[model samples]
Target chain A: AQSVTQLDSQVPVFEEAPVELRCNYSSSVSVYLFWYVQYPNQGLQLLLKYLSGSTLVESINGFEAEFNKSQTSFHLRKPSVHISDTAEYFCAASSGGYNKLIFGAGTRLAVHP
Target chain B: EPEVTQTPSHQVTQMGQEVILRCVPISNHLYFYWYRQILGQKVEFLVSFYNNEISEKSEIFDDQFSVERPDGSNFTLKIRSTKLEDSAMYFCASSDGQGMSIQYFGAGTRLSVL
Candidate 1:
């Protein structure tokens, strides 16, 4: 079965500091990788996705992830993070077209002042 | 941006009682899905609906659970008999099912099975 792994359970960083949330996925078939963010008391929101073409994908909020097939990872990174970025980040992968997404346990990012 | 909508942000039910969680997916989306997340657990997919039928389902969606698109707008998940383990945050999501298949999720209905 396809699965996702988020190595870091929690990451704390000072505001405006660089941070990375590690995510890895395992799937026998080709997969579509995605990064979703969930704010407090809110639903999952799409941060970015890697379908094809570029090896790296960027979200509007300065977050980006690279698709590295050799490493089986799609790690989310931001050079500078804000306090608003504090939330639960989930890494997910879906195989083929329109399949169910396999999600990681999630990484909680805490941005401090 | 359009968003999926779910009714009754929270639901409380006793063990062995039946409950229905309702969702209104984005109007133009072709695929709808149900996912659940236990507190501090990974989000788990329960079922996916498309074209008035179930396209895919996970083992967690057993005989005790059923999904229905009773009307043009409402998609519902009915639990025949709720269990303590069934207490979780139920999320409804939908995607256009086009090229990328980016799904948009709604604020979930937190189901509390007492």
Candidate 2:
């Protein structure tokens, strides 16, 4: 079985400050990693994904995550954040041909002005 | 931008009543899935359907729950007998292929079992 662990349950940052949300996984086989953001009363939106190529993957919204093989981590980072960036973020991992996704408990990001 | 659509954004039903949630995935996608999130909890996978059959399902998808693709565009999830615990936000998703692994999600159906 594959599982995702997001170490932080809540992260509060001032607007325009940098932040990082840590995520780790436990999988016996190769896996795919993804970050999803959920705003209030809205569905989840894919922030970015790490399939295989480069170790670092980026999202159009200025967020990026680096896939660390040895550490089994896929931590999301942003150089600067805005109030609109406040939302619930989830880290997920999938294996076995990507048919299933195991998600973390989720991290709530609060960006204050 | 093609987006998944779900009907009855919110439904309120008494316990033991039957309820069906509907979804219309992207026109070209093949794989469809259902997930549920209880208040203050992580999202949990319920089932996955492909080629008009169930490809995978979690233990939460028991005899009380079933999915059907009644037509080309509509996918439905039926709960035979709802329980108070069944109250949650149910999300429908679809993906075009198995490799890319990017699933597009609907706004979700909020089921409130009273």
Candidate 3:
């Protein structure tokens, strides 16, 4: 079945350290992928997304994701994470447009000062 | 910028009781959606509303779950006779349905069915 998968459940990193949150999805047809972040008591916030055209997508908050069709992966990365980046990150996918988003199990990124 | 709004950030109810979650999507958004996340689980899609009616729904959205846009501004999800297993964080989201439409989400309402 079509689904989103976050390989890591939790990632602990020191402030100013590089981090990567691996995500993979399986879809028989074309798909749109996204990265969403959720802080404590907050809703899921769109961090970045890849619809087409570009193989790499970036967010305003210094996070980037590379979409690899061959690997069925869209892994998020940050060269240097801050303490404020501590939160649960979700990877999601949809058939396209406004279709329902299938979310991954989520990866909790804890950046320590 | 406009954002989606959901009321009653947290709700506590007893099993077998009915509960209604309210949402006000962005005024110009053409698509509305509902999703839920059980504790420590992924966010699961419940239903999607467009043109004042349900355009899509998941198996988790059974007969007991219904959605409505009673007025021009409010979209509501009603759960008839809630169950203990129904406790989850309900999220309301909306999108303009334009090119590569992006869904914006509200903070969500944490429903605890005791």
Each model: TM-score of chain B?
Answer: 0.98, 0.98, 0.98
**lDDT of candidate 1 over A26-68, digit per residue (tens):** 9999899999999999989999999999999999899999999
Q: Which stretches of candidate 3 lie over 4 Å from their true place?
A: none
Better-scoring candidate (DockQ), 1 or 2: 1
lDDT of 3 by residue, A10-31 (tens): 9999999999999999999999
TM-score for all models, in order of appearance? 0.98, 0.98, 0.98
Please compute DockQ, using alpha carbons, for every candidate against the native two-chain complex: 0.78, 0.63, 0.88
**Candidate 2 on B2-113: residue-level lDDT in tens?**
9999999999999999999999999999999999999899989999999999999999999999999999999999999999999999999898865756887899999999
The root-mean-square deviation over C-alpha atoms between each candidate and the true structure, in angstroms, is 0.9, 1.0, 0.9
Report the Cα interface RMSD of each model, rounded to 1 decimal.
1.1, 1.8, 0.8
Off by over 4 Å in 1: none
lDDT of 3 by residue, B36-101 (tens): 999999999999999988999999999999999999999999999999999999999999988789
